[model samples]
Target: MSEPFSLLMAVYRGDHPVHFQKAFTSSVAGQTRRPDQVVLVQDGPVSPGLEGAIEHALADSPAPVLHHRIERNVGLADALAQGLRLSDHDIVARMDADDISLPERFAAQLPAIEGGLDLVGTGMLEFLDDDGSIVGRRVPRTGQAEIERYARFHDPFSHPTVVYRRSAVEHAGGYRPLGLMEDYWLFARMIHAGARVGNLAEPLVMYRVGDGAYARRGGRAQWRSELALQRAFRRIGFTTRGQYLRNVAVRGGYRFVPEPVRKAAYRRFIARGERARRSTRIAR
Candidate 1:
């Protein structure tokens, strides 16, 4: 673990040129404990504008850059699996094109990669929009017991904020295509394989939820969620209580709630997260 580790960042052309560049520069170079090497796995052929952002970000990056561009648009699962195959470190951290990392993300996480844990992820501050403005945080439970309990319900940690041991991923059979919820799919498999998982009680990355694919909610999106839940249930040999509860809420409470009321509830969830982080510093 002491030799050095690589950070694998995946960039789909879905991001705007300015925001993508800002995230790459701020998250990679701006880390307090910088990665020894950084890999930018582009999901498809880049646009002229995105190409420029990639160029500038790499040129200015403090870590060595490894750029992999695919001819076609491979989905998230394949892209991340390819990045993991290309990584040469014991630890491989995940990042997204549209999100920013806090300075102490890895510095705070690397030490926790001790003993038997296969992966370590963090709680995250989620941005309400693409402007890096904070909306609220998702505070994940850390430690083997709590995370294991959480996994029985859903994904144990935030997908983009994890630093995982490569060996553990290989054992879990790597990331697979699961339409919209590849990260959750992988997490379920890892837990079933008896890999030790933990979440750091820190907001290492800013997750942009409503700005992208998650912004649209319709039949297709709902179907994808249903499929993801089914996959999770199959993996664990039982239906998830959390998924059932969500369905009940959406079908029952959400049906009666006004659109404004639903939006207000979500905003309050995020704001409350921000308030929680204000009292606890995950850094030592």
Candidate 2:
């Protein structure tokens, strides 16, 4: 028998209703292997349109939907922590409010989860917000060895594409208020605690990259947050001092570069990675 699981997500005022509707439609109504339960956390007061969208999506959902509302904005990390606590299933899948999970996302992830892996995530295709054109793809390192090695320098899994064992996450102390790098932080802790992590090479989610997404990642405040996260990882023995310094030099350099240069560099890197992934598939 297959292991039953719950889907966890958080929404807030800033999320676009249309995008949220698409996200919900894809995650719930569109999944080939449906979740046993769905837990949606309203991080703060949402617009009436968003409320209607949530209502409309749940009106026909096959799984039982549990909607938890927070009186005010508490950010994604805190909201997700609350949702994780509220979720009743041992296997919980994470989804973002504005991204579309492919129809086979849950189906593809279940094997890894049931095969004793503590955490599993898949690659994602990124699309632009304006015309929804394919912008790039993120194919993170897969398998226990590759994932553990990658985790030393970067996030080895896509946050929204991940389906993790609830007990493992809780054992790692669950989610914390770790600024923009909360997911990274949790994964680091999980790895440090010897959690078995894996990644599906196939892209299973359509991630929306807004116009300001790259810019948002390049600011001084975000740079500081990234540096702090790296330092914390080093202190916790998740990453070595040399690795932390290398990460700081590379990641920090991008934050100070011109926005256009940074954007171009990111695009180039994604294009190369996507090409390599496609070539490997063809070779196989």
Candidate 3:
């Protein structure tokens, strides 16, 4: 028999109730090959509506839902770590409370893990709000070599779209409290530990990118965190001093720039047209 997988998700007070419901429904009820277990961590206190949605989704789900709660807000990193501990299965698939996983996502990812990949992620379509119209797509670099190269400057895998072996994560010390760069930090450690990672060429999740998303990426705190991560990469030999400096000069400057400029740059560089083309191809 194939190793069973558990879907791991963390929810907080700030999450929109409607989005949370849709995300839960899509990940659990909509999956063609549903997870054997769903491990949900309540990061902190949530609104009654959000709580109700979780209850409703869990009540309707076919698979078992293991719910864990923290008394106070411990943030994503710690919350995820807690959830990871609670997950009973050897394979764990990460899901964001505000994103929608496509019906075939689990089915597509299971084979990769079965084939000996330690970590696997898929492309994701970024949409605006709850209407689900695709605004952009993140087509991550596939293959171990390409992923390792991209990991030096950027996160090659979309966190919510990734399915990874629990043993691999445990070997890398699991998730740490790294602020906005927590996922990236963990991925770096996993790569350094010789974890085999890859990304499927097709989008498997609908990522919700709100208007203020880019604005939130800027600011001194974010910049400091990013630079610190780069420095850590250099210290660990994942990046050269020259690469670290170049990252600072480029990504660091973006943090100080106006939001409009950052948005424009994001659309031009990070977002790609390939998702639309892929959708078109799938339609025919």
Candidate 4:
């Protein structure tokens, strides 16, 4: 086994029990290099079935487990913050309650840390369910240059595939409760703070995006949240004035579009981002 590390996850009542069970099995119980401790935060009260599932998964876990229950729903960012604090290891891996991590996920991510990276992430494949019909594949920027350049307008890492040094993240302010863009915000701070980062351009996690995901991508509230995030990025010099305007014009407007339009644009954006990453890699 590799050096001891912790796996962190948060589950809420909204998540299905079956999906959570499979996620725990595929990401924790079946890992080639399992975590030394699995720390899960119950973001809020969950359904009885989901509660039972959590208990069952822990009972069958390969490593020791810490299950923390919150009195009320605190959302993912805050919940993950609590979980991160509960971790016992310096290195921590992240998993979602609904994603299926490959058996070799940690096996692949840990070596990147060995190479001096403080944080490492990989690409992911999006599927509708465990039936395994993949609907989308996301590719991440492999070089630091590409990652920095791309972050002005796009997410450089697939959130679920990230394995990071807890100390490095804590130095960068840990996980803040940013609305809608928590992961991106944390990554921007980490990059700006000069944290060493790397990415594997290969998919290691299977992200579950069920029906109506595109439709749920937009609303008046979502636009407001995104607007706030952009303003914060601008205030912190994470984005140039022109980049900020472009982001507002592009990502901001994306919130009000119809479902069909959002769905088409979403796929195109993914493809364009992947192509851009490839070009940047070649240039490097």
Please write out the lDDT profile of model 1 over residues 1-284, one tens digit for every residue. 45477889888767778768767876677888888888788999777899999999888999988998877889888988888888878788888887778899888877777545678998887776645577666877667877777565556677878988888888878898875667876776777788888887767788776632322433455556655656555556644576656644553344345556656766786576556556555542
Residue-wise C-alpha lDDT for candidate 3, range 121-222, written one tens digit per residue: 998889988566888878778779978987888888889999999999999889988658999999999999999989897889999998689989999989
TM-score between model 1 and native: 0.83
* lDDT (C-alpha) at residue 110 in model 2: 91
What is the TM-score ranking, best to worst? 2, 4, 3, 1
Best by lDDT: 2
**lDDT of the structure predicted as candidate 4:** 0.89
lDDT for 247 (candidate 1)? 47
Off by over 4 Å in 4: 273-284
TM-score head-to-head 1 vs 2, winner: 2
**All candidates' TM-scores?**
0.83, 0.96, 0.94, 0.94
Model 1 regions more than 4 Å off: 1-3, 114-116, 130-132, 209-214, 235-284
lDDT for each residue of candidate 2 in 178-199, tens digit (9 for 90 to 100): 7689999999999989899998
How badly does each model clash, as a count of residue pairs? 0, 0, 0, 0
Candidate order by decreasing lDDT: 2, 3, 4, 1
Root-mean-square deviation per candidate: 3.8, 1.4, 2.9, 2.0
Give each model's whole-structure lDDT.
0.74, 0.90, 0.90, 0.89
**Higher-TM-score candidate of 1 and 3:** 3
The candidate that achieves the highest TM-score relative to the unseen native structure: 2
Quote the lDDT for 234 in model 4. 96
